[model samples]
Target: MHMTAQDSRGSRASTIFIVDDDSGTQQLLADTLSYKGYATRCLSSGRLALTAAAEDPPDLILLDVMMPDMDGFEVCRLLKMDQATRFIPVVMVTSFNEKAMRLKGIAAGADDFISKPIDATEILLRTRNLLLVKQYNDFLKEHAGILEQQVRLRTEELEKVIAELRTTHQQLVQQEKMATIGQLTAGIAHEINNPIGFIASNVTSLGKYCERFLTFIKAQQTTLAACLPDPDQAERLQAMGNQLKLERIIDDVPNIIRETMEGVDRLKSIVMDLKCFSRVNDAEQSIADINQCLESTLNIAGNELKYKTIVKREYGELPPFSCHPQQLNQVFMNLLVNAAHAIDTKGEITVRSWSSNGWIHVSISDTGCGISEQHLSRIFEPFFTTKEPGRGTGLGLSISNEIVRNHGGRIEVESLVGQGSTFTVSIPMKSQGHG
Candidate 1:
């Protein structure tokens, strides 16, 4: 159906050029387009068409595949190659309905291909769509030039998008960390529970010990008052001590205090590790023990791995390297959590590290669902994920890649589709900005 006259009023009238050596076909196409209220020009030769196009370009060209001097492909190529008429949409017109001819036409810059003995309705639809596309492209070009004048506005828009993306990515990372923290709730409580529980028990026992000593003191005082020379209070005290097993209580009280102190120390260590993991020291690069970073990160991810896999650590002795410890901890946490998720019910995760040639190498390998070859290449691409919907935000590896690159590091991956995958990160021992 033709668009309303109102649609055509403000918009420029589109011109169609029918280029075909077949006089009958050309006339028919011209009449069909003319009936659609489109202006039409017919040319029987590619040479004439080229000349006319350069003189006055048409909005869309219907090109015949078989011509006398030049074929449709060559004519289309020459038309597209020219600067003046290249934007005009070329529709390949031919009776040859074959895949090869269609591909050839496409290769030669034909915007569309329509088989010959063209249906009036089909021609109208195809031509109309092509005209619309050309007009839209022209409109874009015009507005794009206007946009070039408003660079600051466009830049502000871009920055806003970038900021939003960064915020979203951070939220995703924090969400994963929070999930890990939830898993750690039980383990950390268990760690703290032991010490506090024992300390409470010890306090109760210490209170009973004090009461027994008080009773013995009262008995000694009564003896002192009753008679001659305090009536062997020392002997009575010794007998009372043996009866109450005071020696054992004295020895055990010291031991309980020591154990409680050790437990308190352990609790302090865990709290300190958690603090270090979350420290704002990430704002500056500093010398850090990579092994310690990994160990602390492993602790954070312990709950994720404990039930799912057996973790083996073949950590080489590491020299302190300049890095943002908190950021590296983030990287390690992401890797560890990913490894844990890769497993179905149970599997093995191996974390290995070493230093070579002034570089530190750390690897996390998992026997889980390995990435398919098709997806492996895009693993570090933002928003590309193989994980099921609502399962993960694909930004983990992407963020890891950014962090590694910022630290002057590179990551290498090896994976088999069903067997396993290994991601190795190698960073400079002395990263840039290290003083």
Candidate 2:
């Protein structure tokens, strides 16, 4: 009789599979292994051993040679061929003394062999050695898996840091660009303001002068009518007046001058808002009406919002607040423009401001596409944006939040995916940064 065994056991009692056609041999092997504190499964045929080993792999396999169905060599070869069972160390048992049979067992992937009239001590020693090697292989595999997971986690963290660096660099570039634009805008506004003043004054004077001229023309017409006295001369004078359309001209001149002056006033307001919105002295704190700041931001951002949205202002009276007006204006502009972009087509952006409980609240609500719950929390995180590339740098909300916090304020947002969104900014009436 001949047999083989394989092993892959850890800390648990090593399970050994005993496969042989002889009942005595099977019983002998099971008893020997069991006595050594190892678990043993006995099977009568090679097919039974293969099926049992595959279904529930043992730590070791004991295979028999010279069976009625299949021999130990064939069984060992089959076990070694399977990826799941291949690692199990196979020990072949045989009664034959032929060198050819030992070579055949070796060729079949047998790790060791036991000859019949099997020595229990020899079998135990061989089984112990094979199991030790299997345990070491398992340890190596587990270690490699842990190292792979660690590398994956570290890679993700590195990527996150790189993204933040890119965002900071982009923000610096944008700030520099804005600084240059602010300087240019301030210069242009100053130059335009002087000409606007001249035009406005001239228009006012021109309106007054035209009114006096019209009064004189009316008096002259009356004097001419009284002096002519003759009906034919009076009729001829009336015909000349009709031909000249003098009455219509007298009525239209004052209205034209009035409209011109109104245009001049509107232009002046725009320039003033532009100047206030682009003020370069951002670090200086001053007394400012928050409502006026919102109005100025709205005017400066009018073109961006007007095409797709209707802006509604609901401002309540509040005391003078201490803050950087220009920075607040910047925050409002960012929020307003973002609201407009959220809207797909026509929508309404409501700017509401009020004061209560020593805090001033300004809420900008939009009837536009609102943020999802998943993305809402990260909206103020730098470099997080839903906008397409080149359309956004994702720093608007981040910068706005920072500015508000510096003024002892906070920004809160509420949104519904399809309906709309409301962003409310609350500031302490007396800011900590102010003197």
Candidate 3:
């Protein structure tokens, strides 16, 4: 068997290995290689060389063409076949100078060839070149592994970002639908109120006529009672009283008028709320109570959430901040309605406001199905929606975001899927003064 190559102190060196059947030739090559700062090993036969390489392969191998038991061709073939030893470069060393024999060694997987009576310098040069090639190969393998790992990490990060964008898009779509509904509320209220107003007025007039007619009949009854001592008129008076039915008319007229009035009042309040929530005026900046705006918006949306959800308000003390009241009203309205709709069955929407650090913060939270982590980053993007087609237009939050930004404020959101979502809006309480 080929002995393991060692340095002067018996530690393995960065290598040059030699294999030959002739002991003298193997020793010569090993000594020459060792003198040139290369670690060297020598083996007596092809079988022994193959065995040694399988145990502890060198960086480069020099195999003799002619050997006992197995030829150099066979040894080279075996080395190339084994994955552990395949990378070691093999240079066939031979005494025969035939072209065919050299070609045979090459075909058997020898990386290079050196004809013997080998020159010391030639052996060293060939070994040095082969070692450089091996070093370069190792570097490439390591670099490839690192590149693959980086690509995998980057891909994961990108996937997470994409998921967040999708979610944000969905939220913005819902907000847009709410905003559109807010804009149309005023017209809708006006259309319903006109008919309600006249109907209530007519009911009031009819009630008064009924009361007068009943009073006239009661006066006739008092006259009949005064003349009751005369039995002749008693039967005629009773027949007249029963035909008029004055008591029944008096009892039923008031209830009809009251019910009509109540319906009209309810319709009128809805119209007032619609006007407050619509923000139809075009003003750049105005001072207004944000809490009042929230209340109006909730009132306008009452019909929307009446059967679907409940709204809870936790309004804190807020200093009046300079803002476009109309635009801000739109923002609050969109957020409130969106929160209500997020619930699939029954849910609660919470609106809270507070002031701190020279800013006013409004938080709208929902107890419905919440947003997922992947979609949180994209909630304000234009045309994003989680709602079905015809139910959403996806531009509400995007527009709200733009309006808030114009007023020097920012909107942020936090959500957990299957739990709930919260949106926080922060706006500067006072505009920056010009120098």
Candidate 4:
């Protein structure tokens, strides 16, 4: 029975190896597979076929089950055991159609079977279908590998983006610190200038007083040298002393020195307070009195509030708590500044502190333009601001919130429009402090 199978694409894109003891069967498979656009190689024995397959694997194998010397079943097992040739499809050709023979062939790794009176159509169909399945499997594996590579690349890119974002956030925090320092520098410069200016003026006055005293001493020496003093000499000496105001100079020098010393002390206190507030690098926590810190911050920020707000303190008794003193000072400064800004004109800002239930609560209340409920919820969000542009950076409350939370604490607020707002900062007696 001579039949020609259709070559689907009319190209030898697939190779089929035929192993048979029968020359007729080998020639038939060759012609049939070649006509179906499959390239074919023929071997008379299973040994030749096994050797050829190991040297160069084929896409499919058609083996006669009852071959001499080495049977097709043995050949199939050998091919299946080899890693390189195992994926190739194998079809068994045998006259025996018994169920036992079929099971035996299947166990030997045969993909399909054809009878002795082989139907050309059956052979072509089985081979074509198996080739299609193998092709599809290969394609899927290739696609999966590409997908895995792409996933790896995307993960790396995401990690890089996260790193950049973290760096930018840190930079913003540092910029805010510098901006706060800038504001403090302006106020402190003015504050320090006041006492220094007056002290310089007092030094000038003291210099004039010293010169006048020297003149009085020289006149007194001249009068002493002439023991038989004339009335006119005595009168001249009294006049000179009166003109010099010697008695008044002697009395005022001590008072002037005292006042100058007081001014110097004031300058020192201001400097010390500023140093405490700006201990940015001293991130270590220590036992500190929040009340004392609040008072010092109040004094440091006094220049900003003095003109527009009257700050009143209602301090309550409190024990020292563990905290980063410098950071808390910054929070106090920010709160006071915000309170002052809320007031358009003169107003009262009262700061109160107390210790209760293993925590310390510090409250800053202002009688000014209060925050609306709509904006209050977003107040702690970074870069959120209600103040006019250029007047605020909107980082104060956000930073304060982070600091408080880090210190094992929290902040609360109460407000009424056009009435006032109160910000209460609460901290545990002992913090999980950071360095």
Q: Per-prediction TM-score, please?
A: 0.36, 0.61, 0.47, 0.39
| Model 1 agreement with the true structure over 374-394: per-residue lDDT tens digits | 888878765567788646656
Ranking by lDDT: 2, 4, 1, 3
The residue pairs in collision within model 3 are 163-374, 164-374, 167-375, 168-378, 168-379, 169-384, 173-394, 176-396
Task: Please list the residue runs of candidate 1 whose C-alpha ends up more than 4 Å from where it truly belongs after superposition.
Answer: 1-282, 433-435
- Model 3: lDDT equals 0.78
Give the deviation of candidate 4 from the true structure as CA RMSD.
Answer: 18.9
In candidate 2, position 360 carries an lDDT of 93
Q: Which stretches of candidate 2 lie over 4 Å from their true place?
A: 1-14, 19-23, 31-58, 63-129, 229-245, 280-363, 368-418, 424-435
Better of 1 and 3 by TM-score: 3
lDDT of 2 by residue, 1-435 (tens): 112232333346778888889999989998888887788888899999999989988877888888898899999999999998898888888899679999999999998888889998888888888777766776687899999999999999999999999999986976676566557767988999999999999889888888888888889988988888688998988999899998888888988998898789777866754565355245688899999999999999999998999999999987897888878888898899899999999999999999999999999999999999999978976557899964665767866776787788899999999899999999998778534
Off by over 4 Å in 4: 1-12, 21-24, 44-56, 66-71, 74-86, 145-159, 177-435
Cα-lDDT of candidate 1: 0.80
Off by over 4 Å in 3: 1-122, 125-250, 280-320, 324-359, 364-423, 428-435
Query: In model 4, how large is the Cα lDDT of residue 375?
Result: 94
- Can you give the lDDT of residue 267 in candidate 2? 79
The Cα local distance difference test for each model comes to 0.80, 0.84, 0.78, 0.81
Tens digit of per-residue lDDT, candidate 4, span 1-435 = 121222223343677899998999888888887887778889989899999999988878999999888998999999999988888889999999899988988999998899878788999889878777666655676789999999999999999999999999986976586558646754775677677777767766775776687678776667675674577877786688789996687667767766776766666554544443333334777889888999999999989899988888999999987788878988888899999999999999999999898999999999999999999987876567887865665768866776786688889999999999999999888666444
Best by the lDDT measure: 2
